[model samples]
Structures are given as C-alpha cells and as structure tokens.
Target: MGSLSASYFERAQEVIPGGVNSPVRAFKSVGGSPLFIQSAKGAYLKDVDGKEYIDLIGSWGPMLFGQAHPSIENAVRDALSKGFSFGAPSYNEVLIAEKIVSMIPSIEKVRLVNSGTEATMAAIRLARAYTKRDKIIKFEGCYHGHGDSFLIAAGSGVATLGTPDSPGVTVSTAKDTLTAVYNDLSSLRNLFEANPTDISAVILEPVVGNMGLVIPEPGFIEGIQQLCKTYGSLLIFDEVMTGFRLSSSGYQGLTNIQPDLTTLGKIIGGGLPVGAYGGKAEIMNMIAPAGPVYQAGTLSGNPLATSAGLAMLNLISEHPEVYDALNQKGKALAEGIRQQLSELQIDGFVNQIGSMFTLFFTNKAVKNFSDAKTSDTAKFGIYFREMLNQGVYLPPSQFESWFLSAALDEAHIDHILKASRIALEKTLMA
Candidate 1:
C-alpha cells in the first residue's frame, strides 16, 4: 500500500520474476501489492512507508525469537568479524552440528545446506542411494521445498499461486515422486501397496504448515512410520517449518516417532538461509566424502549461519520454558481467533500446534489438503487485507501458516485478537 514499496515492486518487476524472489511474497493470492519491509525488530515489521504491523508470518517460520534478536544479532556480528565464507570447515560449523545432533534424536550427523529445498533434495537422493530404490512418497499439500521431485502437488507458495504442480518438472521426476493424501492412512497404505518395494522413502511435514497448519490425524504419522518400516522405506520428516518451532528438537521430539531421516531448516538457521538433513549414521554416511552419494554447497554451514544457529540452539537448550511460553502464546491467539469467529458466526476453523497455526475460513475440520481447500479464499483475502490494515501482519495466503514468535507478549496477543475480531467482522460483510 505504500508508495515506496509500489515503486520498488514496479522496478523489481522489470528484473525479478513477479517482483519477488518467492511467489507468495507477491501477495498474488491475497490480492494486494506486497508490503516492502524496511526493517523488523521484536515482533514488528516496519514497511518502507513507516507503517508497522505485528508480524505473524515471522519470515515464514524462521524468526523464532522475532526479528533481529540481540543474541542472534551479536552472534552474526561476531561471526562477520571473523570474515564470511571459508570454503572449508569451521569450528562454528562443528559446534552447531554437534548441537543439532545432540538435540534432535534422529540426527546422528547433519550436513548443512543453504535452504530447505536443498535439504529435502539431498535427503531424497540419500534415501534413494541408501534404499536402492527409485521412487519416493510425498503427501499432497505437504511441501518439501521446490525440488523437481517435490513440485508435484506441492503446497505453500505453489498452492498459494494455484499451481498444484509446476510446469517445468519433468514427467520422469514426477513419476518417481509418488503422492499421497495427508492424514489418510489408507492413501499411504495404498501407495505403499501399489509401489511395493519401490518406494525409497516417504517424506512429509509431520505437522504440515504448507497446507495451512493441518495437523496429522491421530496415528497418522505413526501409521506412515510403520508402513515405511514394513516396506523398508526410509521415513523422512521434512520439518523445515516445524523444526524447533514445534519443540526443542521438532515435531518428532513431541511425538517420539523416530524418523529414519529428518530434513530441517527455518529456525535452525536462526533466520539465516540454512538447512540440514541427517539420519541414522549409516544412511547419512552415504553423503559426499563420507561415502558415495554426492551433495555439496559452497555456502553450506557458513560461519555466520552457524554462529546464529548455535546461539539460537543454545538459548533453547538452556531455557526449556521457551517452548511452554510459545505454546501458551499460540493457544491464546488461536483461542481468541476461534472466539472471534464464533461471536461473528463465521464458519471458520483454527488449526494450531505450538507457535504455528492457520485460521481457515471453513466450518469443517481441516485434516488434509482437500479439507483445507474448502476454505473461503475470497473471504480470506478480504480478511487478510483487513488484518493488514489493522496492523496485524499475517501470512498473505489462505494456504500458509502464521508463526508466533517468543517476542510476542500478552499485549501483542491481545492486539492480534482485537485485529482479528474487526477483520473477521469485515470479512463477513465482504
């Protein structure tokens, strides 16, 4: 809405595709020009026009402590002082690796990458090499980055843009990536049965954020784990969105469902561009110099990323209460939103876990992507703009999850709820 942002976007459109690096950031689905942020600090994002909003997107689930936390900032500063890329090993990388391995039960050794896409891509390759199979299973609406294999039925920005499957993905790559319905055991079972021993791995967001915070139905994740075990398929938890945000370790930590492999990003980078995938030692050992399957990044485990991540992990490790606080904050916000919807007699559902949630403009329980599709996207669009006008910045799509950060206090939660009430009311009028 700001003139400066509009000017920047118009300029960017000449060079950057869609005037944004990522698709959803264009606010295509929400029907508005995206706000170009000037800066963010402690739960607030300041647009170039000097307008500030309570940031619920949280940089798409990485700003766990909100933007520019003192500790993380200091960590980055210190690391920056040591120079940038080493193109070689660094002590910070080792320290962060050890922290990750020690925290996440499934990760024996983690190889860092630059983004979630790289992490999931590498994980799949490792899975194929380890299992000696060509095909893998991925759930519908559970995005595992934009890897060619994952573009089929991908969620998040892909879903937001209404392209369930991207065009450039090769048919062969699509064939190797089997699709299943999320939270539906029968669908997964059918995939396994049909594929038989061909599925190298079954990867999913254990608590899907891409399809707007759709939680797994009871025993859904466990069923997938069992099927993977029965068929000798590696069960991979793509916790790019849920990692650390869900629990200290991830959704796996909360459920104790031991995945054969895990892909992590977002909070692990402490708001930096970083990702990691790790699993049973034997399986992970197959990556790079450790064994045969090759995956490398020049910026992998960069000093700055490692330093920030290490600081984040250390904070979480030392203060277990952060999770509790986050959960409480999520509950408060979710409950307030539900209450607002009920009071307005709006047909809406709030699916939440920990600090991640979605308010679907539907009456039905959203257990899968199909249910998620039932949301009134038009109404959601109106609500989104209204909320933005009210200074509450939410994820700019009906298909994305909003992240609550530790920086949000009681006052911030109250402000969000007040904004939600007005937004929901306005949405009904629309």
Candidate 2:
C-alpha cells in the first residue's frame, strides 16, 4: 500500500508551497518525508499511517501538560460556546494579562498579539520609540521571529534551511539590526563600542533554544544586561519558548536579571496562536490608544486563546512542583543519552536544560552558534530517521531543541532511552 503521509505530501505539494507551511516541517535537513500527525494524547503522537511514537517536540514547547489536556480542552470548549473572537476586550484577557504581570517582574503591563513574530516586531518598534534610537542588537542564531530585523543571522528554520540571512529583509533593515555572537560578551561589547549611541536595545533568548538548546555561559546574560545598561540600551528577553516552560517568570525568574521589555508566545497560548509584549508601564504606555507608537490586530486577544492560556497558566501556577518533575525527567533523559554514547563509543554532545535539550552529533561542547554548526548534519539525519523507525519522534532538524512535557513519565523516558541506544548503534553503522 502507498504510504498515507507520502500521498498527502504529494497532494499538499500541488497546493501548499514546499508541501509544508513551515520550512522545518519539510524535513529538508533531516532527509525524509515528515510524518503527518493524526492526533496526540499525553506523551504519544499517532501519525496519519497509524504509526505511534513518543513525542519529544511537545508542539515546539507549549504542551506543558501534554496534548489535549482535559482542563485546557474544557476551557477552549467553554470559550467556543461564547465565541471565538470579539475584536474587543474580554475578561479572560484581563485575567491572563494580570496573571502574566504578577508572574513576570519586568512586565507591569502587556498587550496580546497573534504570534511571536508580531510580539517581536512590536517590541523592536517600542524599543526604538522609547529610546529614540534606530539600531538594535540581537545575538546570532537567536531568532526573534521572522521579523525583517531578525531575519539576518536568524536560527531555527532559517538556520536549518542553511540560509542565515533571508531575502525579503532590505539592506537598510539588516544594517540597523546588528548581530553579535551568542555567549560572547566581547562580540556584544564590540558592537556597542562601534555603534556608539545609535543602538536602541539588546534583545536575546535568556536561555537560547533556537540554536539547539545552547545554554548561556556563567555570566553571559548578566554581562549582556550590564552592557545594555552601560550603553543606555534597553535589554529585551525574547522568551517565547522558555517563558512558562522554564518557570512561571520565564528565564528572568531564573537569572533575576530584569529586562526592559519581554516578548512571549508558545506556552502562554496553551499551544494556540497567541503572543504578547510588555514591560514597564512607562514604555508600554507609548503603545497606541494611549501613546503615539501604534500596534493593533483584529484578533489581538481572541477569546478562545485567552481561555486556553488562562487554564494552562492556572495549572502551572497551582502546581509549582511541575517544574521539579520536568527537570528530573530532563536529567534522566540526558543521563540515559550520555550513557548510550559512552557504551556505543559514539562521539556526541548533549546540551540540556529543564525539559529542553538537544543531542548534537559532535564531540565539541556547543557554547554558541558557531560551535553548534560543527555538528554532523548527515549523521544526525541518519539518527533522526532511525529513531523514527524505532517509534521515537524527535525534532526533524538537528538545529532545533526537543521539548519534554509534564505528560512524559518514567516509562516514556525508558522507552526513549532504549530507542536511542538502538538508533545510535544503527547510526554509527550507517
């Protein structure tokens, strides 16, 4: 019988460009037809062809309690009965905003948007207006969405597709958006010194997941904050992937380094399409209806999205222990992968944080985007396909992080480790 996923891809290619809406979904780097998911429950995903695999992407880091959670589904259903969107303010929006403000120290106010891209695009404009400066600094491989300013030296799909710079972004936009090396304080300092007072803000992923779960060095984040303070540049933390996944306050809570602005998405929407940008009221007041900087959307605070987000955040807020449980699972998975590499005598590098990780096909310690590029993409492709064959679904690209949900249990971890052992052994042979 012909594969259902392959058949669907064939038809999709006739209609959808590249047979995928997102570049990473095309599996260009992984070298295989991507699996079309039918449904998900807890820690497992059932493909269109009836193949079941333990899901490790967690919908790209929003399914904290796993797919189709009862409470979240119920919330969405209730919201559906009322309406999907009002195009006006709703109570749930106020509640979610209040919750976020209470949790995140830097954000005294927030405005909801449709996606991370919108939040970041709005944030850069706000930063420019507040600081009255044109240039902004972003770390290499730290993707702040597909904003024209961020397309230069972007990561995630852009990095996976081997095009660090995108075409649509004009030379003027690229010039204003300065790129610096991740985890390298010297590179950032050089930009500040070279640009002088032209820079408006320095934005980064406090715990970078775009470049395959690259962790900041001991004082890297602190140094960036200091540099921003020194240069009068606002520090903005793009916490779309790490926000609620790391802790209630996101990376800011972990490091206690307050940023001038924060951009959030993913978990905040409970896997729905939503994003938000907020910081001190003084700066946020500069946004439209209140201030001169104008930003608006038809579905800015969609009723269904707010309801789902509130449900998810409420669960996380009530069960603080979920973070501990997630970290434990991460440690177990990291150790298991390390053991497999040791037993199989394979050269690999594992970068892991609480519930987010990447197993790079390289022996070098990946501290930055340059180091992450040293990974053997060809070997990773083999390993990814082999793992899929072993009923373990991972991110299609080596440049992406694998997210673990609270839905994953010890049994799932054991199964993933067993699959890894087999996949690694097969990978070496291939």
Top model number, lDDT: 2
The residue pairs in collision within model 2 are none
Relative to the unseen true structure, what is the C-alpha lDDT of residue 5 in candidate 1, on a scale of 0 to 100? Answer: 88
Give candidates' CA RMSD values in order.
1.0, 0.8
Q: What lDDT would each prediction earn against the true structure?
A: 0.91, 0.92
Off by over 4 Å in 2: none
* Cα lDDT of model 1 by residue, 1-430, tens digit: 4399899999999999999999899988989798899999999999999999999989998898889999999999999998999999999889999999999988899999999999999999999999899999999998988889999988988888888899889998888988999988999899888989799999999999998998888889888988988999999999988888888889999986989999998888898999999889989888889899999889999999999999989988887888889989989988998888888899999988888889999989999999999999999999999999999999999999999988999999998888888888898777
Provide the lDDT at 207 for model 2. Answer: 89
Q: Model 2 scores what on Cα lDDT?
A: 0.92
Candidate 2 total steric clashes: 0
Query: Candidate 1: lDDT over CA atoms?
Result: 0.91
